[model samples]
Target: MAVDTTPAAPSHPEGGDSGGEAVRPLLSGAPAEEEGEEEELDVRYAPYARRDAYGVMGRGPLSPAQVARLVLAAAFLLPLRLVAGVFLVVAYYLVCRICTLFVDGLEEGRPRLQGWRREAVLRAGRGLSRAMLFVFGFYWIPMSDRSVPNAEDVHQDQSAELERPGAIVSNHVSYVDVLYHMSASSPSFVAKNSVSKLPLIGLISKCLGCIFVQRESKGSDSKGVSGAVTERVQEVSQDNNSPMVLLFPEGTTTNGDYLLPFKTGAFLARAPVQPVILRYPYKRFSPAWDSMDGARHVFLLLCQVANYIEVVHLPIYYPSEQEKDDPRLYANNVRKLLAIEGNLTLSNLGLAEKRVYHAALNGNSPRALHQKDD
Candidate 1:
């Protein structure tokens, strides 16, 4: 049997071969080997000897430490949001007044000039809005799927045609969507006439050139809200310095996972429609409706949100080039794209996309009311 002189297989220390184990080259206190022997040992043992270190810690749910920190942060930041909200209302009113004054003056001097001075003042309101959210810990991740870039990136795109304004529409997910747009593009939204009545926010809307649409008044005078939106779009298109008109075609905010059918009013802007899709990747901690109630939920989420925001500007779709140039058709095209982009998140959560076959169609669903053919 040759005295059983074969070598025994090597043994590893405790912890097995898990990636978290640490390894050493040789036994501690062992004498150094000869150069040839060391080289031979390296060749023989290199592959199996090394061990991987543990990865950096991640926020899984919230640890005790994280919970404690979040609580403390919220305790400080929540009240701050309340105070800031008041300031925002006040700043918005002042800025709106200034803009309104300038517009009135411009109307007198050169009625053809499509300039709104309050946009500059709105910058302050926007800043305050961002700060309030920031103090609460709201974070955003930059998204890359959409061509509708942020204000800075918008300038870099030669094809974007900053001088040629268009109706830029997006799905409504949350009231935060409004703030997000204001921060990134400073575009005016088609707000309800009622929003214009809110103490401070309302006055601001009226003064800042918000296209206030009235549901009941649909005569030729202003098309009420619809007509107002058209005028706003025309004004924006006429100015080389104007912010793109941002509209929530869906007309209301959803829980962010589902997309509603877009209201046709935005499509009626007569300008080419610039379809924009915005998605917030909150991972496991995504702010859901169940997890977060309406307005109060938003305030709470602001404090615990991650530190990044993603705004994916997909390729801009032009209504002028799209088949069936009707606003409803253009809206469908946008809805389709959004459906594709947000399908996984929405469907996984059992949410359905709303349909907008008719402008008169309205539903309680946060998104549009569409039959899901899928």
Candidate 2:
């Protein structure tokens, strides 16, 4: 017998009964909330959202294939990379110690190292920094120079001297960002006072003429770190032989997608700055150091078979008269320029928001959070 197949008549029309409100399709793209209604606050909307900060690591459960890849990497790659990294650090430490052997006044303050000693330290530091990055799996780095009449094209004479920027301002994304900068320019950096006490790295930092800040001290500003930075900027501008001062005006790392409000410390002297933007384009793992613990970051970084960094160098930015009179104006203008050139989102959220996000991720109580100077 043939089966009957026919459509049933709808109890109500598509718009529902004429007097009733229209029925919406289940798959309709319209938002559930009414227009102009205030939406509830969500972690995902925050600039430094925990999900974005953690990248693929926090993206739910891993597949069996992913688990196998990680297992293989840990079993083989991790040990070799760790050993090579340590060896490079120790070898570079010895070189730094030897270079600074006859140099005095480091204990009192930063003293200018000239002649062969300076050359030896700078060259060795650059080479070893690149080597360390290689061990960590950054085999290739692509740098793009977008400076008008690029710094390299300028003649090495009075004109060049006058045009040189006092400092290189870049966004901070990870500790590896330091390695790239060190390899490229061997510039001095502003670091926390605690970093000056770490083994091997402490002496290396001092030898690099790093300016150390007592970040925990309430009177650190009065203690001369800011004054020293201003003086160093001026010094670098005037002295051709002086190392370029590198400052992360953001004062902290982010997820590499947003640019935070820049601190005025790097622009206080009103010296021209060469803005360099660094980006790590990744597939499975993000190279950003936003929310990961140091050890875990290192482990995953080494586990990855390959990684990449793209560097963009912008033209030297000169402060206008108004900016010169106001450091905040100088900083904001540069920040805006960087945001435009680098295609980065300008975020009002700064380090405080980052700290709160991290605290929440780690399950810390709200009261346990403390305000930190940016």
Candidate 3:
């Protein structure tokens, strides 16, 4: 049998597709060794390839048609979004209030709560997160992969000493990642230290057991965080419901096109680690934070009718003999595994470098809003 080898040219209306993401080839310049092998290469990394060269916030000027769409969307959604934002903030505050009273140690200098009181707090946090997601039109698409091959199910790992997720390492991109992860795992995050000072947000984050870290922090600050992560991971006992510590190893956000270099912080712990991947698919507005101001990003996201998030939770990785001894190697190995599974290509640049790149492109620092306060 002879197969048609000619490629079919794509035909479209004046406007191209806008529903699903359009994936492009990440690999180029390689000569095809054999027929059909080029296609295999294209499809390999296609699912996570980037179509635009610039970051999400560098979406450039909108066309007149796009401007009209934005205006219309804002006219219809502005009032509703404001109301929803207020309602969510009030609801979150109330929930945190309840958590402080009932949840042990959440009140500060207190011991851990026993039994139902603790459960009540956990349930409240999860419920609040889901409510926030609902208000923002963020919905998760669930998927998983097992590079470690420890078991078929997450629950099955309960029998092993690993038990429930002790530490979670994920690729960072958006603020919404916290909401999704909190709802899913009830884990404490190793967040940016600035998060601990953001008014009501900071207070609530502490109540939720979040561990905030200073970026590239050194001396006592780094040591303190290292000890904290170690303590949190070690605290995940045999109980399946015990809390897990979460870390975004990229140390900052990207446009979701490339996987940034992984920081070695999370691997400092000896406990079992869980790798998580998150992608927010968008057409109207991207949820990925880049050079955009925070307030503008929030408004853009809230104005959208619907937004989709994709989650991939890989199996819990028990440290091999090599990983057990070397945290740096362990971090790199886990990062490589995630990049392959997530269909993400590794980028040499980290978030700091990206910020500089963004500034050069825009002729202003991405941190301009912050600098303005000075």
Candidate 4:
């Protein structure tokens, strides 16, 4: 039988090939691929409540010697992690205060941030993010030293007025994706409106000028929030000096092995998008928030001495006629590219479906689930 040559759409996380037989390619700028199909990646996407889908964020479990080393390392770092956490909180407050002071001075006429004030905010955000990630035992390793290029260098067709990327979209896996992105570029984000109320984290996010999406708010109210996202993107895209905005279209976290359907909110902005792929590669502790309790996931990472993550930044995706005409295609194309570059399988399940599946797994089902193909 002649082998099938066409690339099929990436598979669902539940029924997809592993892309490789649990292979842990050496750390590099690109996703390491195997000779052929990855071992059948049978992992399922579920809430952290279920503990089965998150297989060690690598090929398999760690060796006894490796486990011993990790334990010893954790023991040696516990005190430092505690002290660093406290110091970071204080340091982050200072970063926010400095940005706010500058912003207050610059807000004379244009409500939108621009000029050197924006750069100061972005730089401060990145600095604080680096500190946070370090204290959390995670490292943000960019795939390449070439940072997000000026729109002129990477995608020139962008008109002088609207070329700079207003949106940086990425695949969401662990809860730490935001940390990694900020460490690379101080981009604002489209996050849940409720996030703005979450103590220090919320306060800092607001200071960073993040646009919050009301995921639970339904009907015209939610639509209004979505509209706000587009308006915000539009207002900021024309200015080269504005801070880049970032969002996770996946909207939900998945194991590093596959992608969930992307939400079109980011694409709705109709602005150029830069896709960044985040993969948490680990030998024992899976950085994925899937199937493990949220508290447990955080505690596990904190107890570990250090963890490594691969941050793959792909070329920016400029909107073509077709993409602009159909945001769904735009979102899918970007999602597809991230999956291919990250060596992850793709799925059609959006965050809603994932939530439904979680309920199903827990022996509960929605009374009338109206699933959308988009």
Candidate 2: tens digits of C-alpha lDDT, residues 1-374: 11112211112211112321122221123256622211111222234432221232243345587679989999999999999999989998898788778788667436568889889889998999999999888999888898775555443443434556889999988899999999988999988888877899988888888888886888786337878899889889888898999999998887676678898888888788889998877666667787668888887789989888889988788666678799998898888888777667666766776675566455453335644322
- Shift in Å, residue 120, candidate 1: 2.5
> By TM-score, is 1 or 4 better?
4
**Candidate 4 similarity to native, TM-score:** 0.72
Better of 1 and 3 by lDDT: 3
Best by lDDT: 2
Better of 3 and 4 by lDDT: 3
What do the candidate models score in CA lDDT, each in turn? 0.49, 0.72, 0.63, 0.62
Q: Give a tens-digit lDDT track for model 4, residues 216-252.
A: 7575475686687788777667866556777777777
For 269-300, candidate 3 gives per-residue lDDT tens digits of 66678888887776656677755778877877
Residue 230 local lDDT, model 4 = 82
Superposition TM-score, candidate 3 onto the true structure: 0.74
**lDDT (C-alpha) at residue 343 in model 4:** 74
